[model samples]
Target chain A: MRLIITTMAIIVAIWLIPFVLSDESGLKFGWPYSVFFTLATLFGGFLFYLLRMPPMGPFTSSRRAIGSVVLVFLVSIGIITLLANVSPQFAFEGAATAGATAEERGKAVFNDPKVGCFLCHTVQGAGGTRGPDLTHIATVAANRKPGMSAQDYLKESLENPGAYVVPSFDNIMPPVAKALSPEAFSDLMTYLKALK
Target chain B: MPPDVPLINDRLVLWVVSELHLLFAAFVLGSPIFIVISEILGVRTRDARFERLARETMRIVAISYSLTALFGAAMTFVLVARYQTLSNFIFQRFYPIFGLYATFIVVETILMYAYLYSWDALERRKSLHISIGVALNVVGTLVMFLMNGVGSFMLTPPSSPDRARLWELVNNATWTGLNLHRFIANIAFGGFMVALFAAFMYLTSRKEEDSAFYDWMGYIGNFIGVAALIALPVAGYIYTKEIFAYNATISTLLMADKLAWFFVIQGTMVGLLFLGAGYYMWLSIQRIKGGPRFRTYFRGVFWVALIGLIIWLVPQNFLPSLTTKPAGPIGEVAIPEKAIFLGLMPAKGLAVSAIILVTAFLYLLYRQAIATGTMTWGRIDTKAQLTLTFLPAMAVYTMTFMGAVRESARGEWHIFQFMADKSAESYLTPLGYAATVSGLITVIFFLLVSGIFWLGFKVGH
Candidate 1:
């Protein structure tokens, strides 16, 4: 019962302090309200628990400890979820808005959840480490294997990732030849080519 | 296209959560390295002390593993929910790798439990148990290396075309160097934490035998920490060189520009670490039945360390940047030309190296002093135990500040040159704010870690 009350008090303080004490007030008072309120709520809870509970403390009861754990976890998750969902400005939809040119469209495909190119390959240096970095794929694709041209190497590798595993990398990439249509594949290739 | 959400600084949110996650991750990754070492030492020497210590260490590791998972899951949620586009890009690129990483986690979890629970049942099959220890270490090290590769890619990404090849990105310019640095650092951190636990046990232990046992454990823990500490600077140097090679601008930003003060702060903490270790070792020499013959030798070491620290902490720049207005009067002092070398890279690097070498030499002397049988085990006093506590605290603080420096070095970009952090909430956080947040997070991290350690004490007892 005390744990529930203490947690509620802290939560209320978190919300109330921010609403009541504006930024100007915080600056004028020469105190960080967030830090002060947080510390106060914590100290208050500690004092409440110590004065009300027995000498040994609340944690002596396994039930109380477990309750506090569950309460804290739920409260933390609740706040984090609220913050994330409520604040859309924190999210980026740049790629979604910028897919126009062939290269840009290819980037979209590379970043697309459906195409899953990024699942194995990095475009322009920021992707998966499971496969090799393809930042300079256009430069090295032709020379990676003998008797294989750049296009041939890319095609063969996409169709059969295990055929020519890079020396240091594990051959864990599943064949994606069936996954990408020729047009989408071409678009990805365009993105890859523009990477240089 | 920023999402139409209301105000709340997501960058600050990410920074705090990620820092917390990293602290736990360090302990989780670091503890196993020493656990395996302690186990192997026991098996070879047939020393029951080593075996007991290893078991105790495993208990703590088991408790911390859950916290690590909890924080890791939280960090992932922040990435996916708060920065959806950025998370989507990374996830799309490495979903399969993520799958593999998850599989490793499951295997690692089972191995960790088996290693902890089957201690007595598999007592007779010692070889099999040892093999499990080795497997646990292997998987743990592999996980660190894999993550290091990903982290290195963010700082020094491959050029566009090379980024196409997943293997190339996996083996990015900074990957090997970072792996090596982190590997050494993990061992050192693990050893420090073990020493901290042993010190705590020694302080609270009522029985003479228990105190003696923990005193010995604390000594060995510090020993491993010093051993790893000796190699840390060299690995760090190599990592920095690789960063320089990959991108001069980013390296410059870290070492000489806006982030330079963080390095100075890191150097001060590192200098304190050396001094703390030296003081602890000097105090520990009292355990010798005969008086410490190396008192004069360690005095000289203290001098070297102090001098090195003074040189290392010398501010590289006293003035604010040309673009920014000075914060205070001290920021108006123009740096003298000839005295600039004192704050330069070579001077700072050499000073740090000297400090490390001096610390290492003191440790070697301690080992020799102990080997002569003149030193009896377990006479470490409360003061020495207090020093052990300070060492890990300083290390945690240093790591948090350095983490800030590293993340902030990229300026406004999330992926260095490749992608910009274009969200409405994205901005380069001022150093004052960053440092304040980092300090707060460090305190919270240490408190939580201490809580975990205390909880483990309840379980172990």
Candidate 2:
């Protein structure tokens, strides 16, 4: 059982990591189901491994704990049924509320159709993990640079995502001001100021 | 062609298309529930006979799944054809969630192949396989939640949403209620379907013991059906509450005078079905020599289910319109109060009747399970029992993670689209409707499926 789970999990992890990373979404099939399939395949491929080993508990029948079986069955069925009937709007609201926050709200400004600079930079643990972490730039710079304020440092980072590449990170931040109208640049700057 | 004929044709086309999508979703959504229940039943009673029940349910779902996928494909086309504006917005606004769905689609396809072939592999690790099935059902459910996030975003667009941060997506607010609602609905849908299948088998079987088998299975199915039916009201309330929380105006659209009446009618008919199922289970129990000897127990269930139905079916209110509007900046919208929620439920006077109805259904199930003699999975052949267990579990966990990913990443859609100057409407809203209409279609189509299954199996009777 351990082998089956381990082998299958590894294979699934390989697929999942890439599927999630870099975010190039190809319309793929169900991953959870595929993981079991992988486990099943490996189980078949390694059938000799099990047969050769001593059996556990005399290879007991697949019977298991059954108390509350009926109740569980009914509950499961009822839950699925309710889900099937309601509108999509309801589902989103429930999931959203469970995970909402202020940092997220401030971060959302980057994804705002109007001023979306946070998309490239890290702010308050939100946005692309691609950029340098900017969660406490003010405090850090106040300590590190001795005299430079947080606002000046952040401004330099935004107009130029590359100016000071944090050690070991890529120096690939494009100069966004070149892409945006002066107004857009200002709006993004204003949104970022509110974040501090 | 006459002008109205085209309009009528349009309605018919929409209905047919809708049925196809929903029917497919039903099978996709319903399969794992059937599998899990069967697995649970087989393991507990030391009876593999329950395994066969699970297989039959899956096979039926498999047949429908093909059609479901077909209609799913069609629904995508329908979006482009019928609801282009909405479709455009969905793609634009909900690109992140959609992207995740796209990735999972590949996973689902891979899993389907494994499901088709894993019988051999599972035979080797039968218990593990079963666990995987449990997990698969979870994944199936997670997929729905992720889809729901994208779908729900349409009707209730998040306020001042950060379209890019995945975390913001997590905070969308509607995902939990929608997920819970869908989860419950699938269970009910699956239970009804299994019962429907068993009923077909009983109606047509030639073997003397076949009646016994079908009767027992149907009885169990009926219990699930009735229980699920009872749970529907509470589920519906949660759903309405979520909608009210999101936007009272949309809730009003959903609960317009005529639509409310439609729901009342729907509730009444389903209530009648519950009573019918309970009655049938009661009769099936009579076939057993040592059935529960309590007529009052049976009578209680009937009257209670009836009363519950009548009470629930009562127009949205009984007292005068004492329900006042909520005072606030959002005051144009009627705030649904806690008192109003109470008033909407069946009157307390009928609570006893509802209890009896639920009790009767439970009694019928208890008696039937006792008589079946097949509740023990251990009694069935080990080799046969090993097939198809646990594949869905992998699906469940991964899909859940995906949903978690989607849930977490959902905020990123806003973050991405805002920078891109794209409205979430370009992707979120239309795709959601397409999914919605498709889900409804899947339901209608599956009912048609039950009818077909009935006809095919009935001939042998």
Candidate 3:
């Protein structure tokens, strides 16, 4: 009983630190994050206590063995719950609230989490290196395929990605058309055309 | 273009069948290596128990070999029918080598059956019988090595595929590392399966002698499993380093961008394996007369493993996937700068190395206990047997999880940079979805393996 009280006291004390600091310093460490850290610290304390126990024998009864498994299972579920709760939720506010202009909205669409364009393609200095950098894509798009205009090429690349494989790149571009609203698709095309 | 199969998730079907194939394949290929060793020991020690163990395990290999072939044939059909375009490309590139692969498989099957059927006939000529066992291992390993060439070629194909010779294509950048990793893993996996079999038999045996023999067998099986497991980290490190050397972009995609969450789960499962192995060792030690004397050493080892596990579970980002933002107000706040260092490679690498070291140390302690004290077989607590059972499940889950991570690391490509998966199923599935599929595969495999164990017992009776 005393050990339980002491553990609770320590957890409460640790949890208060983040809460108080965030309130005073204008930081945004939310309640869920604080709860996660507190639980993690509590788990650490539990491990420390377990380590300090006297040398033990093998579990002599089926009940004891099952109880141990139950304890481990509960702890595992707790960890999974905490992780899931702390994970970021998906949102499209970034694209939805951007300026109404085609290029501006297109840029927003490109960076939107729902669209996930930046996960593979780089523009300027940001995004991933898996696909080609689109920093100068506007200039190169026109010359990529003869008799095809820059807008036409970019449109084809988005709709039918396997139509023309780039010389040095794999044909890995997904059909972004499926992921976009028609308006968002138009905006994304304008954004790509204006990359120069 | 890849052909589409109606009314089914083609990739998921292929994933399940291929994973099942690999599981059975690992057992067949891995068990023979140790079976030969057991046979040799039986001859040298003049111990009939060793001889019985060798024969019993050979029976299991015989049963599992057919499952391996069945799954292999199913996977082949799926590849030919659903993935015709990619299949054609590979077939055209390595037509002659596929013939060699087929020939080796046929030869391996013939040799395996002969070794099993000739156990008694060559009992008088123990040397010749042992020779056949060794010959069987050689052919099984060659079969795996040749297939490794084709698998690794997909990940790290030659730079100039149009002009590269056949040998160069086979000996790609990641081929040797993968071969070494899989070789060690096969031994470890085989050992766990053996332990699982022993645990089941021990639990169900009505006679004291059977229980005692199974108890000893479980120890040996777990010993082999943990021994190989201790060496796996180094092999895995070499494989990862080779991948980085082959392509930095692909490495980034795995470690940082898309597949990082999958790796985090893998680390957790691996930590469970070490914990399970350590706990079983601790329990086994208690059954020895003088084992309690080593309690101090066990405590220290336990602390090392616990700390290592905590460090390994830390993720670089709190986000579950790349595209999402942190929920609620936390979304506006970045992960604190100070906490970032703990999640990175330097700390994680140190933690993994420490975990491996502690496991090895625990095994050494178990060995010392056995050397100094008398082992009371069939006298271990039920919990120890349960732990023995748990190790195999963890091992299977780890295998399936890691396999998923490796295949998913290819992302939208059918063959890395060489060929694209332009099928309807080209995109990367979410980590949660892939994990669910992997879990399903693990459960199905356990059920089938249990059936195989039952059949082997019936046949022996």
Candidate closest to the true structure, highest lDDT = 3
Give per-model CA RMSD.
17.0, 22.0, 8.2
Q: Write the per-residue lDDT of candidate 2 for residues B106-183, one digit (tens) a residue.
A: 666555545545746786576766766666666666667777776556434565443445545544556677677667
DockQ of each: 0.02, 0.01, 0.10
| TM-scores for every candidate against the unseen true structure | 0.68, 0.52, 0.79
- Give candidate 1 regions above 4 Å deviation: A1-196, B1-8, B161-163, B322-332, B459-461
Model 1 C-alpha lDDT per residue in residues B193-269, reported as the tens digit of each score: 88878876776666778878988888888887778878988998999899888876577556654455566556656
Off by over 4 Å in 2: A1-196, B1-5, B8-15, B160-171, B253-258, B290-292, B316-461
**How does chain A of every candidate compare to the true chain A by TM-score?**
0.52, 0.39, 0.52
Superposed by TM-score, candidate 1 places the C-alpha of residue B330 at a distance from the truth, in angstroms, of: 10
Best by DockQ: 3
Q: After superposition, how far is residue B318 of candidate 3 from its true place, in Å?
A: 1.4
Per-residue C-alpha lDDT of model 3 across residues B66-138, encoded as one tens digit per residue: 9999999999999999999888988888888899989989998989999999998997998888888899999
What is candidate 1's TM-score against the reference? 0.68
lDDT of 2: 0.47
Clashes of each: 31, 132, 0
The order by descending DockQ is: 3, 1, 2
